[model samples]
Target: MKNFKNKVAAITGAGSGMGRELAIQLAEQGCHLALSDVNESGLAETVRIVKNRNNSVIITNQKLDVADRSAVFQWASQAAKDHGKVNLIFNNAGIAFGSTIEGFEEKDFKRVIDINFWGVVHGTQAFLPYLKTSGEGHVINTSSVFGIIAVPGTSAYNASKFAVRGFTETLRQELDVMKCGVSATSVHPGGIQTAIAKSSQINESLKSLGLDPSHAKDKMAAQFITTPKKAASMILKGVRKNSRRVLIGPDAGFADLMQRIFPGAYQVLVGKLLLRRMR
Candidate 1:
């Protein structure tokens, strides 16, 4: 927990963005890695980058869909087998979706929940036993600033992220009560520069709210000031400190503050800002 040297970590969504940066940084610190992602090519690239930098670090990868419970358990078992013991599981794999609650499609909403919420559940349950056995462990679940404060045109995404925040917090409390060596941190990243926006599923329902679906990705990306490297560094620092919650960027910090100060009234302010942006 103090350092990653010689410790083994299993990361979901290790192919790109903060996930890839985490793999790179952990390798630099001499941690062995078990990486998984649905994108085979991206997963390969991550492995390649890590190997090129640290030949001594052992790296194993799988083409994994974190939404699949069985597959996640299998990967967890394999990671434990390959690395001998697992100290950390970063449930970082998630997808983005944009839709108005009234206009949302069931299928689209289900997809978002399955990937963003259920994926974290699967990863945490799958890897937790191994972590307990390791005697020192941490669960890092990626939420979002929206988890702290909701906005329009992202009902499904907000639901999933809020679910992650609640789930991780309860898990952390249980781990503490049990006096387990394992702990959990809920991460709220405020639009770190990532392909999530470009790759997001923006529903036509957003147009019902007078928001241009086509411009949604660009608008979201424009808010991403923190780099992936910076986000990863913050996350690792949180892990080392055993922090209960990790806010990645200044925007996340601001959102948390606003929510704390205004609570219910912040929703109105957010709505006004979003309406101004749409104009």
Candidate 2:
């Protein structure tokens, strides 16, 4: 963990966003990588970018859906054998699905929960043995700023991310008490420029909020993101220091502070602010 040089990292969602950036950063330090994503082109693109900087580092690519328990377990086992002592596993793959309670379909809800929530669980549990065996490994799970507070029009996503936050937090405590060498980090990131929003299954309630799909997408793109590369750098820095919580943006830090300081105050304050225009 202290020395990333020549260590191996197995990252989920390595096709894009923070995952891709992590690969680039780790590869720059001469760490070997085993990257997985559902999108072949994006995966190849990430590998290409990393190799462009350093071709000597070992790079392995796999097309994986982290929600598939059998596949996830199989891939983790194979990756340990292939890479030899996987020192890091970034459980970073996620999807966003926005919907109201009554309006969301079961399939849409399940898809978000499966990928955003269960995917983290699958990756952590499936890969923990290998990571533990690797000695001085770290597990990083991506939660969201919304996980600290339920955001409007993102109920399903909020639920899944919140679940991830809770799960990772508890796991960290258990590991500490048991004296596990592998430390854990829960990432709370404010909107980064990713395909998540573009891919959201926004429902009627979201549409009724008078947010033009195109305009909202553009606004999110412009407004609150910390760059994927910077996010990756922060994550690695946190893992190096074995920090329990890593906040990636001003928005995330603000939300985190309010959540712990005045959880109810922010909750009601945000509710009234959002409802003022509607009324």
TM-score of each: 0.98, 0.94
Candidate 1 residues 74-176, lDDT tens each? 9999999999999999999999888889887899899899999999999999999999999999999999998999998888999999999999999999999
Candidate 1 colliding pairs:
none
| Model 2: how far residue 33 lies from native, Å | 0.5
What Cα-based lDDT does every candidate model obtain?
0.94, 0.85
Off by over 4 Å in 1: none
lDDT of each residue in 1-279, candidate 2, tens digit only: 676998999999999999999999999999999999998999999999999999999999999998899999988888888887788889999987655677788899899999999999999999888878876788899999888887666788889999999999998998898786888999988868777667655655556655554455544556556889889999899998889989888878888887889877897776565444433
